[model samples]
Target: MPCQSSEELNVLVKEAREFTKDGKVADYIPALGRANPHDLSIAIQYPDGQCISAGDIERKMSLQSISKVISLALVLMDRGPSYVFDRVGMEPTGDPFNSIAKLETSSPAKPLNPMINAGALVVTHMIKGNSIDERFQRLLSFIRELGNDATIQYSEEVAKSEFNTAYLNRSLSYFLKQHHIIQEDVEELIDLYTRQCAIEMNCLELARIGLIFAMDGVDPDSGKQIIPVHIARICKTFMVTCGMYNASGEFAIKIGIPAKSGVSGGIMGAVPGKFGIGIFGPALDEKGNSIAGIKLLELLSKNYQLSMF
Candidate 1:
């Protein structure tokens, strides 16, 4: 209800679009580099099933790091919190999302948190499955349920691109393997992880998934709990603490919501029992967040007093 109409949201999107010029699209992975730096989009899904949008909300993009939060939720459901937390810490790191410096120095050699590459790799490894195919299918099925879209699938081109260039992630996996944090084959884990990151969807679908989290993991349409309330709380806590990479603190202070962003310029925000927001702005700031998307969030949070704080 805070954003009453698409016309109002479009005004904010237009204003925030100006900041896209200040950012650059991520090109480390060859496929991700092809995004139009100026493109921006947003969608909001209310619990009552009403949705409002601005820009190209149907354009599909990879999930990138946003998949980490979903994977974490699935793993927690699979292995339970005690087992998952025993291997990965709950703290946030000031370092970059892929940094392994802390992994080398941590007393027990565990990653600082699940949002980082090291920790995500560990979490993915913990997903319950008998084989890589079976494991990936399980994760994929969960994603489809969250989006409420049966057609949702991973981008083979993007997945291949990421898999080929995932040297840092491979190194992190090996390090975790050496410490016995992840006992699986490095290549297998990387394959699954890259595919996980490459799962693609448009803004509206992303918004629907965010709505589930906003409603404490309940599917508003079905009245079913996809994720338990306690687990939803844990996932939202991480989104507040580490979801925006190292920029999480500033984002929390500015936007004051549980949101997760990805290098693909996708942001999924849960406004806590109100509505879910999804944004995609491929032009990334220096910290790898969607430049215009964050600006739009700032505008929305301020104009509507949407901040939970």
Candidate 2:
């Protein structure tokens, strides 16, 4: 039943690409706009070390919002979930990824979930470091470990592009500061957050990260515990509830997997006890998930009955 065969996956990926017409590339970041919106690819790896890939398989893109998954785990491992959750909440905001409106409205003013910009800024402030550079370096180091590859690092060009025009994220940081959720320099945290988002990797590397979660914090291939089991469970829960931005509920209802999607049009999915799936489809739906990627996952989950639900 494993469709790791290249021919089977190639046909499936081609079929999924038709859905790309329903979405658009995230040009608001300008640098991300350069992604060939027409590009669509997928990679799925199971715990046994088998892999399935189709189309643009080697293409690299920034982690974008998907970096939040690592940041949340790092904070939980560093300060414990009790401390981290006190600063942020576990619930989904049901608002847009960058919605500042949620700040003024939510009680106690904690960013709803770490997946959103406001919440991610709060976690970035909590990362231990003497300077912005130190913090991001630590984060990048952790991310590289998750990917199980030393060569992965932040995309300097993408970081510069996002930092120069990150007006919305800047606003979110100031709002968190005002709410007392972030007690540090706004610009420093913003720089850390922006650079973290620019960490670049391809689908194969992403599958490694996802497999760590699927294996409950242990790297299935290496047998090393990358994070604590409890922390990994919390992250997986957030992915099920908030990973796809506002469309999280729909994604869960359909795909029923713990996954995270970035504005750069990359999605990382962990199928518990089964496989780690990585997808890149630059065209995104209204809620910011990859259009073709979501469709492909739907096809996979349905045909293979991979949904957890």
Candidate 3:
């Protein structure tokens, strides 16, 4: 049976929360380490604008890897997909987000796609801005327009922690520079990318952001086009092909929605004119996807028949 109300979704959320006991929260970033491992939330925004939310829906968390989708969308809008594609390929790497082996050996050394940290850094550098703050302001403004919420901001704690330990990303940026993949100053580009990943939002706001993609890049509530339809489609396609690190294939097979997950344990899924699902559970599986969040999405997809496949 379809989930008829928030009460039913609440049950699913509770069941999903139980799975967090076996997962581990990301600890690489000190700020992300503080997340409650069992805190699971789900918020779904339908095409008609009705929203149903469950446990811990109001709890705020960093966007983490989930920000990649938004950042890529902004880049695509600012510079067409062809320009963006020149820096980042659309294929899945089948490797961890921070892997550097490909850069050392691959012919071009370009990141496989923008959904990974390496690729995101490249895409961030491609965002036509004169300064780091200009790029970030444009990014934040674009994201806020998608979410229809003006309160979103970067968490200094998270940003500082991420910046302090961003050696892998820094190395990736330098490698991209060596390969002629990144044109801007590596430090400035990485700073912009890290700050973008540190953006904080509750599940409700995230769901609204997903809803824009669900509505084919239009903000359903205000009827404004936040992203062009073709770009939105490309974004969704990349989400399916490469969003979940090495686990994208499994997620696509099982859940069948174009979704992205962050090491901070947030997932954003777009159901193509049906609904946008936002899930947060600070514990993650090995692939860096939120464990409980993925479980909840699977159950919700089964219950609501929301899969695009």
- lDDT of the candidates, in the order given: 0.94, 0.88, 0.85
Off by over 4 Å in 1: 1-5
1-309 in candidate 1: lDDT tens per residue?
Answer: 333349988999999999999999999999999999999999999988889999989899999999999999999999899999999999999999999999999989999999999999999999999999899999999999999999999999999999999999999999999999999899999999999999999999899999999999999999999999999989999999999999999999999999999999999999999999999999999888999999999999999888888
Better of 2 and 3 by TM-score: 2
Q: TM-score of each candidate?
A: 0.98, 0.97, 0.96
Instruction: Compose the digit string of candidate 2's lDDT tens values, residues 168-252.
Output: 9888888878878888887777778889999999998898789888888998867888899999999999999999999999999
- Kindly report which residue stretches of model 3 are placed more than 4 angstroms away from their true locations once superposed: 1-5
User: Which residue pairs in model 1 clash with each other?
Assistant: none
lDDT string for model 3 (124-210, tens) is 787777788988998898877777778889998888899889998989988888888887777777678889889999888888888
Number of clashes recorded per candidate: 0, 0, 0
List runs of model 2 lying over 4 Å from the truth.
Answer: 1-5
Clashing pairs in 2: none
Evaluate residue 33 in candidate 2 and report its C-alpha lDDT on the 0 to 100 scale: 91
Arrange candidates, best lDDT first.
1, 2, 3
The residue pairs found clashing in candidate 3 are none
